[model samples]
Structures are given as C-alpha cells and as structure tokens.
Target chain A: MGPVPDRPATSSRTPADRPATASGPGRVLIAVYAIFAVAATSRAAVQIATRFDEAPVPYALSAFAAVVYVLATFALARTGPTWWRVALVSCSVEMTGVLVVGTLSVFDRAAFPDATVWSNFGMGYLFIPLVLPVIGLLWLRRTRPA
Target chain B: MITGYAIAVAACAAGVAIWAFVLVVLHREPEKPLLMGVGALEALLAVQVVISVVMLIGGGEPGSMLTFLAYLVGSLLVLPLGTVWALAERTRSSTAILGILCLTVPVLLLRMVEVWGGASA
Candidate 1:
C-alpha cells in the first residue's frame, strides 16, 4: 500500500541511490512480465502434464518462453548495472525468440500443431508477446546507465 | 451469462476510457477514486469466479476441467495483482498497467466462457 521505497517522493537522487523497488513505468512493465511468466509457465505446465502427446514442440517452446519471461522480469525489476545488463540480454533473446518461432511456426505448421507463446509471433496472444520485448528493450535503454 | 458478458464489455470500455483520461486529460498519478473503480471490477471478477464454480457444480463442467479451472483462476488473479502494482507507482505508467490488465481480463474471461460453453454444449 505504501509508495515504492526505491523512488523518493520528488527527490533528485540518481537511479543507483534509489531503492531497488520497482516504480513508475518500471512497475507496470514488471507487472506485465510477471503476468506473462506466470501465464506461460502455467500454460506449459498444464499442457505438458495433461496432454504432452498433443504437441511436444509447442509445449517445450512455451516452457522456454516462460523461463525467459521470468528472467527478464527479474532483470528489469533489479536496479543495479549488472541487472540492467541481464535485462538487455534477456530482452534481446526474447526478441529473437519471437521472430524465430513466428517464422518457423509459419513455415513448419506440422511442427506446431498446438500454439506456444511465441508461435506465429504470438498471434494467440494478440502479438503482445512479440511486441513486449521490443518495448522492454526500449525501456531498458531509456533507463540505462549514462 | 448475458449480464456477465455485458459487465466484461463495460469493464473493457471503462479501462480504455480511464487510459485515455490518464494519458491525455489528467496527466497525473492514478487517483484514489479510479483505483476504487478498479476495485469494483475486481469484486465483479470475484463474483464471476463464484458463478463459474457454481455453474460447474450445477452440471455445466467443461471438457478440460483442469485448463478451465486454470483460466478461471488466472482471470481472477490479474486484477488484484494489477491493482497493487499500480498502487505502488500511482502514476500514468501505473494507469497504463491498469489499462493493460483490464484489457487482458475480458479477453481471458471470454476465452474461459468459450471453453466452458463449448464443452457444455
């Protein structure tokens, strides 16, 4: 219920001096990434647990995407320079994952009978899965160390 | 069912309106009143969860009980989490977070309804 401790109320301290707690657009972005991590992991778990026979490739992709999302969320929420580097790497990987998975899903429909988070550029996810990484990377860039 | 659908639609519309207001008009942090409105939506979602459970108990179970339940739970979760996350920021970005979660809820709810209705029918 309290305001994020990381940010002083209208203070002029630098990002390093600020607490590591997420705030502002960072809060929103973390929320989104956290949601996706939960969603993708849960979906993959259910699919794999209940009917792994349905589509193994897509299911595995879902699990992989879920892990990336988890890492990216953590990295973005962290305040230090090391975490910033981690976020940059994860976002780049995420962007590549979406592109590769989207193109492969299109060219090789036989491999993806069921959809994964990255399938068809996250078409089932309104392409947000694809777009999120670009936005995340941009946000990181905007907040990067000078 | 009709009322639920209507409410979901209304929630989505309200979310868009709030986003517009936040991004354009207010240019301020997320106000308490608007947060209360989102709280109201969360309460409605809680009602929807209860209704869904009741419907399942009343001989309206979906084919994939597990998946259906997961979605039902997921739809219920987004609001409170979004609310808290936005509360932390209390800024336009927070409002944007609320908007995103609001938009996501209806989509998930509709999907749950579809899965439920499809299996039952």
Candidate 2:
C-alpha cells in the first residue's frame, strides 16, 4: 500500500555523506552477522578440507550457512534498498536453515556424523546462530520503511 | 596450553561479566580503566600464544596442527581487533562488543588447549 514498510535509511542520503556501516541496532546486527560469516566460513573450510568423508551432509550445510552469513553481513553493511532486500533474503534463509538443520540433526544423528554450524541448534556456538536470525528479523522490522 | 588457556578463560569470564553488567545493566561504555584491563588480557593472550607454540615445537602438537595454529593466532588477535572496533563506536554498544570479544577469546583459547592437550600430551 505505502511503498512497503522498512525502506532503507541510507537510501535518502547523498553518496558523499552516506554512512558506511549500519547505524545503531543495525550496526550491532552487522557485527554479529560478520562474525558468523567468518566463523562459519572458516569452520566449513576446515571441515571440508581435512575430513570431507567424515560427514558430507553437515559439512555442506556448514558451507551453506557460511554463504548465508556472508550475504547477510554484506547486505546489512551496504546502503540502500537493494542491500536491505539482500539482507532480508539471506536472513530468512539462515533462519530456515538453522531450524531445519537443527531439528534434523537432533532427530537423526546418523545424518550428521559431525557437527555443522547449525547442528544441535548451534549449541556449540553458544546458540547464537539460533538467536541471531530472530534478532535480525526484529531489527529489520524496526527499520522497515515508513 | 592448559595453564594459559585456564587463565584466559577465567579472565574472559570475569571481563565479559563485568562489561555485560556495565553496558547492559548500567547502559554505559567502558571507561579507560576497562580498556586498560582488556589490554592486560591481550598481553596474557600473547603470552599464551608463546607458551602454546613452545609446547607445540617441543613435541606436543595437536591432531590438526593447522587448525590449532589458526586458533592460536586468532586468539591472539581478538583483543586488539576488538579494542579497535569498540573504540570506533565509543558507546554502550562498543562496550558490549568488547565484552563479547572477551568472552569469545577464552572459548577459542579453551578449544586450542583441548586440541593440543587431547592429542600429543
């Protein structure tokens, strides 16, 4: 109806004065997203390189999670609506991935011989992986276009 | 690795709890003294890295030397990187970041310890 809510705040600013990083809660979210990107990427790299045969499914999932985190970090950090949509897409995917992977890993341990980023509901990573998307969604809602 | 990691973990637990109280509960940024404290922690982590490396060279290598090396290097870098990142914000958020990093370093250190201690002890 009204151009969809949560329009990006950075969209209106001139290129010269436009802020580099997201502001306030957005900044915090970006930081978390960035951390996850680094952590997941590195973990996947190690897992796949050292022991690909250990658990193909979980390792692949780890790589997937890493991509989502990377995209979310970039989207959250970039300015304008394009990046906002990117962030939303990646965050949604991340949430779904964690939920599905978390549940499956628990119900079917055989499927996950080794732990991925989303394994055990990300318990190894302090459950931050589970909580992060929920927070990201909330932050997105709050910053939605008026 | 065990001794250094134990000290690191203890320090991080204390540091993060304090910062969490200050930032989340009190809603304030860390003062100069807190920053200095982090610096102290960083020094300890540097020392840990040295100890771990020595142990590794002395024939106590982990199962995966590469991963262990990466974690060792990462743990050492956390405090300095965190301090820089937090200083830019200079707000309650920054302090929270510091706390989180502090907490993370110890966890990383613990993992490093376990990896080394588990294998070639």
- Compare the candidates by DockQ and give the number of the best one: 1
In candidate 2, stretches whose alpha carbon ends up further than 4 angstroms from where it belongs are A1-21, B119-121
Error of 1 at B10 (Å): 5.5
lDDT of each: 0.75, 0.73
After TM-score superposition, the amount by which residue A116's alpha carbon in candidate 1 deviates from its true location, in angstroms, is 0.6
Q: Which lDDT tens digits does candidate 1 get at residues B23-66?
A: 52445556666667777777777777788788788887576788
True contacts kept of each: 0.41, 0.04
lDDT of 1 at A136: 89
Tens-digit lDDT track of model 2 for B1-121: 7664566556765765576556545666667767777887777777777887787778885867878887887777767866776665555666666777677776776677677766311
Model 2 local distance difference test score? 0.73
Q: Assess every candidate by TM-score.
A: 0.86, 0.85
Q: Which docking category, incorrect, acceptable, medium or high, applies to candidate 2?
A: incorrect
Evaluated at residue A137, the lDDT of candidate 2 is 83
